[model samples]
Target: MQLIGRDAETGVLEEFLGRVRAGESHAFALVGESGAGKTALLQHIAERASGCLVVRVEGVQPEADLAFAGLYQLLTQLPVRFDQLPAAHREALRTAAGMRPGSLNWLAISLAVRHILFAASDKQPLICLVDDEQWLDHASVHVLAFTARRLGTRPVGLVFASREPSSEIAGLPFLKLNGLTDSAARALLDSTLAAPVDPAVRDRIIADAHGNPLAILDIPDEPLGGFALPLVTKDEWHLDTLPDETRRLMQVAAADFVGDPVLVWRAADKLGIAARAANPAIEAGLLELDTLVRFRHPAMRRAAYWSATLPQRQEIHQALGDVTDQRTDPDRRAWHHAHATPGPQEAIAAELERCTVRAQSRGGLSAAAAFLERAAILTPEPAQRARRLFAAAAAKHDAGARNQALELVAAALAGPLSAGERAKAEQLRDQLRTATSLMDEVRRAVEAGGNTDEVCIESVLEAWRGVEPTTADDYAKAVLYNGIGRHDAARDAALRALHTPLVITELAEAAARTGHFDLVKALPDPVGDWASGIQARIDALLTEGAQADAHHRDSITYLDRTHVRIELARAHLLYGEWLRREHRRIDARAQLRTALEIFTSMGAEAFSTRAQRELRATGETARKRTQPNHNTLTAQETQVAQLARDGLSNPEIGTRLFISPRTVQYHLRKVFAKLDITSRTQLDRVMLG
Candidate 1:
């Protein structure tokens, strides 16, 4: 499907491509909350940028010793003089690249990442794609600035995509994204949601998501309505429902500046220090204690810290690594050994059903697996942990993390687990083994960089070409013709995409993109017709009590809407339409403005230019509607009116001020009418003269 929204981002990318194609240096910093589609957008842009060799290094939050993993991935491929690298980062990147996932030589690894790109040959302008610069090591941070400055005049655009604002990559061309607009969000709901939703309820769901596209589409059900959902800052969650003991443990863990065993112990000690015994909040699932006393989510710790008593709170983060120094337990001592930040959630069961439900709702199957890893680590019983581990592996397989999923499943089945857990793992392991093979093929296909569309077409044609002409293929042809400026061809293709006997999701998407406005649905129902058909269906579904499923289904409409907006931008550019906000949706304009501001702040000239172009074209326009003011009143007229307003009769005013009674009467009448006050007493509320 075509991408929607991201006008500002696409404009910046087009500008970068234009510069690179012309052999100029440019960079773009793509910023958005996680799941705002940064990686997907980057991939699309890279695919389209002419003559640009795109090398992507996805950022993963590694434990301390593995900090430079991203940089290592790049350095391993380039045949560069390790000895010739700048003294500042040469050894650091090399050493870190050689370390394991959970190790901690951050100083060296971080340094290596900074200089890894320096290994790039002056051979060509390379477009390096980096995801999550916010977690980059110090060396990587230093080298990023150096490379950006040193490579000027070379056809290179370092596309840095991040979730949070990073001071390191500040002053580069930035494109910050907010959630999709109501229309975009609705479009997403239309495609993914299985059940129907009422229009009013769907809108309310969007509002709850706070305009964050990922959040709107992911909210599973009302039962966990208030859980930590996306686009919500950590500061917003309410704490009244949580056990006080859970809150206490969380506050303590948050104190160490890091959450490890030593810090947990320190935080726990305080509960007793203040004369309150440490209670069992463990039963409520508020806190976990295996190697360390920790909360399920980082937000949990943050909230506790923020709400803690100031005097005690100040001592918690003991200056980065103070408390765990003297730990004896191998498990608890492990906590103080690393200095990385905590993650969103830490479920101690490998098969995290709650998280999976949330993930599926949000379309984040991969994340569900990652979260379940915590459950694996935190579970007390070996058998329970094994079961969770296997569940996590299976979930990972579903999420396309085939390798990780395969490894986890194998380990669970082969481990010294209980009969039940082991039996489940053995069965799941076989299933995963089969999936892993398909994943291997897909990865190979993705890596070949062959014509993606042709590959897709070949597969579809091989199966269904003879039976009936694929509507999607028909649509593709229309798109190709449209690209050559054939409006009629584009229209026909769009019609085919809409009219073809296809999946409900595909039809809704085609309609939304092609302007068959009636095909779009009002609710999150997947089966909405060409008009308000789906909204009606959603209502029917809701009358029967499938609220959660309805919400789950409705979110896809918004995701699809997001894709369409991106496609929309592509169309506008193709047709030579102005990249301005005037012709765009209000929500699009807002996201674009934010993205533009970020790019501009990043010192990305090309991207900033594009942002400005969009802002100029689409931002609200204020016409020069000036009101010419021309009013005249004599001082005598004012004095007369003032007296008349002071409760004096016209003759009395004339006698007091030595004026003619006729003039006084005239002024009083004018003042009364002009001031819109009939009674003399009302003159106080109005100013006359």
Candidate 2:
């Protein structure tokens, strides 16, 4: 196959191979969306790796739970001599590969793989390519990640291709492939077509493809005039032509999100289909068979599943549910049961609810939200469904999927609810809305023509009327009074809301703003790391130069929670104001601009406006606020730049951030490029300007 539109990616792979040949080790992850040429790029690298000993493994969903599945595949391909390794290393590898009777040890397996790869590199530089790393077994992923990190100066290269995000690689260097450029897509289309295409039709195809090379080639040769091309549906193009049995197998494969072939085949066997029935689809490029069955792309999986009738899909789910082990994979079993039961199955809903709890216990908020959403769909009672929807919304909110959380809240509101449930829903809606649109909410509250103090007091009284008032309710009252210029009342309400450390910090700020300096000093120490953070801000405001700077640094190091990110933003704003007063205009401008960027991005309208005012006071015109650019420096980059400007060297910055000096240099290089400056001296001007 002729590869097109991956010059930059191919160049990076070539460089990695060159370094490996020169006795240096390297690891890179190729991350992109499905059908974005990740697999193609990996294949191109393998073909071009002339003298290197290449070993390849592709992760299968069904085998993800099978210990050492990916690692076993890679190790088997290497010409390794078992007798050459140390006895412990040899036994560990043998045990992990199931050639010996012993439990698998993670450290021994990792060391064994590392030693084998290093030994192979002495004969020829070794290159290990792992495709679809998201589906790799947890054990294999951990071992390979360990080996990749410890390669040191060995002549080996580890490269991975994944459609998922960078989380799988654990901070390994990665090259992300976006859609091809317009010219590249056009050139690919030109070469792909057998006959000359009409200029008008060509233009339409180019536009419809949207720079995806695969989509452009998948366009049919029929009349193109007035014909609509689905942008992302090309992966399903040839599926309808497959045999019924093959198509059925594809649907079953699609039904399992993990693509576990064991479960798929088990379900297929229950349906009286032979294993050979899936070969047609596999040959047609619609599916692939490894340790598990997989669709060629995620879109194909969706197409296969959606193409089946609801009854047919329910039958497939029933088969899968029956075969799935209840104890070993209760989440998957519950999920299958939820889908298999037609409507309003209380048993299935309860099972999914239990799964949601388990997911929450593991800190999988997104997974918990998904389970609750499914439970809501399967719930028979109206009130129970409403509660599930509300719970799912809350989980989504905690997971930072704010827009989806609001949508779920709206869905919950449309259903039946008791008065308390209704109040909770309304409160949640108000809280989420206030976080993103405080200015709008405040304007609406004021325009209602009620006395600000009376309304604030009424809200507080109504909230307290409940069996127990929540901190949220008290915080709302504080914000309402603060927005209306009732500083004393705001301070009082803020103090009442001091339940969590975050709320204590909020109260401290409100007290300081109301000229209650004594109250700020007298505030009880908040629990957790935030105690240091809140104290740091208080100390910065109350103390002198060097001590104040130390406080600010401590505050920055302790700020991590999303809900309290605004406090971090406030710290930067206060630090900038202090620097400006001290005539450190350059440093002040950088800090002020960072605060403005964070405030605007978070939709804190009042604070962002305040930051803009501060920037102007520092003698730099605040440009008209625009949507944040995706390419702009990240929060970590901004922090690193600020610390560097404060006269910290790479090692000092690394110590403060808890990263290696090399990592610090790497981040600085990226910071310098993003700010379009050559040296640290230019950072303040370029970053602030």
User: How do the predictions measure up, each by TM-score?
Assistant: 0.33, 0.37
Which is the leading candidate under lDDT? Answer: 2
Q: Residue-pair clashes per candidate, as listed? A: 64, 1
lDDT of 1: 0.49
| Cα lDDT of model 1 by residue, 219-264, tens digit | 4432111111222235654655655655655566554432345446
TM-score between candidate 1 and the true structure: 0.33
Candidate 1 clash total?
64
* Candidate-wise lDDT, in order: 0.49, 0.71
lDDT per residue (tens digit) for residues 1-689 in model 2? 56777877788888888999999999988888767888888888889889989999999989978988998899889888989899999888888878999887889989998998998898889999999998898888889988888999989999988877336485898898888887898999887654344354465456545577667777643222211111224344566787888888888877765556788899999987789988888777667766645555445665787777889888988898889999977867787777888778888998988877654543246667767877888888888999999988887787656677888898899999778988888777756764444333333333222224433433432221111223346666565454333558768877776552233444556676677867664336444444566677777766778898777766655543213445556677777777888898987776677666656654555566667887899898657765434247766577788888888999899777644354456568768866778899888787662
lDDT, candidate 2, at 594: 63
Lowest summed lDDT across 10 adjacent residues in model 2 is found at 222-231
